[model samples]
Target: MNVAPVTPPRPLDVAAVFPQLVPLARTATRLHPRPGAPTWYDSSIGGPLLWPADEPWPHCEGPHEVDGMNPVLSPADVRLERRIRAASHGREMTPQEQKTLERIRPPRKLPMRPAVQPYDGSMAMLPVAQLYARDVPDLRAPKGTDLLQVLWCPFDHPIMPRTALFWRSAATVTDILGTPPEPPAMQFDAYLPEPCLLHPEQITEYPDHLELSTELQEQLSQWSVPQADEEDMDPQTYYDCVLSNAPGWKVGGWAAWDSTDPCPRPCPECGTGMEVLLTIATFEEGDDEGRSWSPYENPAAEPSPGSDHFDPGRPTAVQIGRGHRQHLYICPAAPEHPHLELMT
Candidate 1:
């Protein structure tokens, strides 16, 4: 079913070269999400959650500001558009398909639904991910919890969509929700994720060199990749891109804070430090993103450039601000404490 290898291939034994990095190793679950029709019981991205039917669906009470860039469209419209695009790829659309397209996106008008009022109303949240602890070995859930459900408002709260976290006992959810509520209209179509099944692979990760101690950072700068081609790259740059925090969808690993690498995200309620719970990323890695970071066992299976097919790199099709990452941090002191969201 396209599950990724647990031990992803790496060019160099990083820890062998950098002995000091051994103790810094932290296990992270790489959720290699590939497009599939996932059911409620499956651990998936943009899939149905194993939610109790009686529980009220979460909604975002927002004062949403619509930038001209976002053209509001209903979830149904988005799905239809996707289907039309896929069906017509590399071929001319049938007359009926063209008519259906026009019905969804009529000339000189925007797609909208009468019931949507996100400008000053509560909008039902869309499922971002649903992870069962059994599927993700690195999922550090609360004592009574075995499932983690993530949902997000389709409208941008600041620059990125706001997300909510829910932890529950899978056994307690006796009756599954037949159909959860969807927002009448969403600001951006990218907010609607393509359903993807997870191939959770546990891997070790170290903090970004920028997030390391000054001494460790200094030490790293002196060690470049032994490879002939990468020898030209700076030592720290190689480590940061190839050996440090992995990219794409993952749980409980170092966050790629890039320019905003303060790294000390303390809990708002308690003084205890926060930990990264999830990272919703735009693109999965390829050879271009460094061989070490990519989870693909076969290089040829990677998405080819200029192809009119589904790009595996963007299987979920969820993009944060300007193609950045949306990281959710939970309080280490108490999982129930309000989670924090950051875009980087």
Candidate 2:
């Protein structure tokens, strides 16, 4: 009797794999901290709520859990907590304690994502992805191969909605596979406003044709089978294309109205053309969709429901008047205060 021989599974490429592992160790920031007041980071549900160590956080009940890791902190989360506790007790942390605290504390990042470009005629809930290059030594990677891909998830940004943190394919994956004969995009109809746990295997494929741009068309045209230098390509462009066709604003917080004459143009960061997810006219509709509404909507409308007077001191929403493209941008300089205008 002939027996089939079992081949050993390929060895874990330790040298090639360690480079990717470093990213997991980088401390992740809580975009919506439990103890902070409301901001765009709280765009999801009832807005940001205080998460005091003395009390429990509000829990969501459903088929999938929205509440984060149980108790006050995970093992990894404890290091940062201890540091703050020690400081509050009026004691200096030891050198070892300091190092561990740094490893667990969130890194400082610029406020992005919510950036608006009136000139580009677009509004973005968040910067889709920020790319950084790192070096890796691979046993199989040719001696000259050095750069590796480091793509950040959009929901990781504090200002973006928790629901927006869906899985996105790596740009390098496409570079290696080449553009599929039929590239797919996520179905707009499939996205849910609420957050849910998703498994890696459950990822969906979307078509590449929903919203197209001339630059994107040119890039897609140039993709040939088995191409080199695929690692450096920008895959976010493909996402921007798909989002351009999204049925409606997925999250609601702030809306911009450009001073241009005719209509608000789509944001270059978000829309293919001049994309306005909401106008002053639609601010009320967005407020109805989520807890946030524009202060400009009813200058007389209360900041929070049931308040006696509107916080006229709060920033105004960008008015989308008739225009080709406003040169203004969502002010990155003032994340807490985002309004429509130029990129400057």
Candidate 3:
């Protein structure tokens, strides 16, 4: 089912407050994905991609160690656990409930030796996300290409889930490969994304606080606020409400560099600066109301009573350090040039 576009919250007019920021706006498209199966031509997460039959499918050759155990739980077990938790909210679990809980979440066995072991060469790469230029206007594929496909190994590299990028023309793919190889095992459930269609919504964005110069920072801090009849507003609050970094998954928006200083990665093949192609985020919105970039047409609409915790940002079921975003950058000069991934 097609959902309505999310209405982006009105950001504070920083340019009007600080004239220097007028030229800093950039367009971003939020690709909202939900859980379902997708076709080759559709924009989806963890879905079959349009590819030539002759092209070799990508796979991860690991000496891969089982980074962690990801227990597969049945939906019935999940429902039962939820019921037990809901019923026992304010009271201790009854003996029967305790036994059921124990059975639901059995103790996991620890590896006999050091967990670091070589990959047995059985893991296969899985499709992560696919986007067509027709769906996302901001997708920066090569001159002749109209599609971007991302695949990653299920296990983590030293840098965590390593990904590969492919750019191609949808028109050129006359023979689509029907069956793709699947990963034998996944280290975490978060690594597996339920297929979702994209409801791409375009919006304008500004640079994060760290990107601002010291003078601009001071100006932001010292700007005089118009006094309301009752109270005065803090300039810092204005900045936070308007000028702070945009959170969650986005395309062509400013990078959320909360963990460290800005590290501009250069293209290995060419000297051109790489641009952010996509940001895989953990949550759609944080506690800050200003960062609520929901694409729903009506922002005030409430979710179903029991589904209030539904998070749009985690649609892909992918997470980085402490739920930080994984930023993928591409060379501006050449779209097919090797891409870079950074988790912040």
* Top-scoring candidate (lDDT): 1
State how far residue 92 of model 2 sits from its true place (Å). 15
Q: Which ten residues in a row have the lowest lDDT in candidate 2?
A: 196-205
**Once model 2 is optimally superposed onto the true structure by TM-score, how far is the C-alpha of residue 202 displaced, in angstroms?**
30
- Which runs in model 1 stand beyond 4 Å of their true positions? 1-7, 102-118, 225-236, 286-289, 298-309
How would you encode candidate 1's per-residue C-alpha lDDT over 1-344 as one tens digit per residue? Answer: 44354546666777887788889888889998877778988999998999999999999888676654335688999898888888687799999999988887666545444443437678999999999999998788888999999999999887888888999999999999998999988888889998877888888888877777898777777655454245455454777777777888999888876657665788999868898899899877732334456654633264324222256568788888777888898987788888988888
Query: Model 3: per-residue lDDT, tens digit, 318-342?
Result: 6676777788998889878888888
The TM-scores of all predictions, comma-separated, are 0.88, 0.17, 0.79
- Decide which is better by lDDT, 1 or 2: 1
Query: In model 2, where do residues sit more than 4 Å from their true spots?
Result: 1-36, 39-47, 50-96, 99-249, 252-344
The C-alpha RMSD of each candidate to the native structure, in angstroms, is 4.2, 25.2, 5.4
Greater-TM-score candidate between 1 and 3: 1
In Å, residue 233's CA in model 3 sits off its true spot by 11
Among all candidates shown, the one with the greatest TM-score: 1
lDDT of each: 0.79, 0.23, 0.69
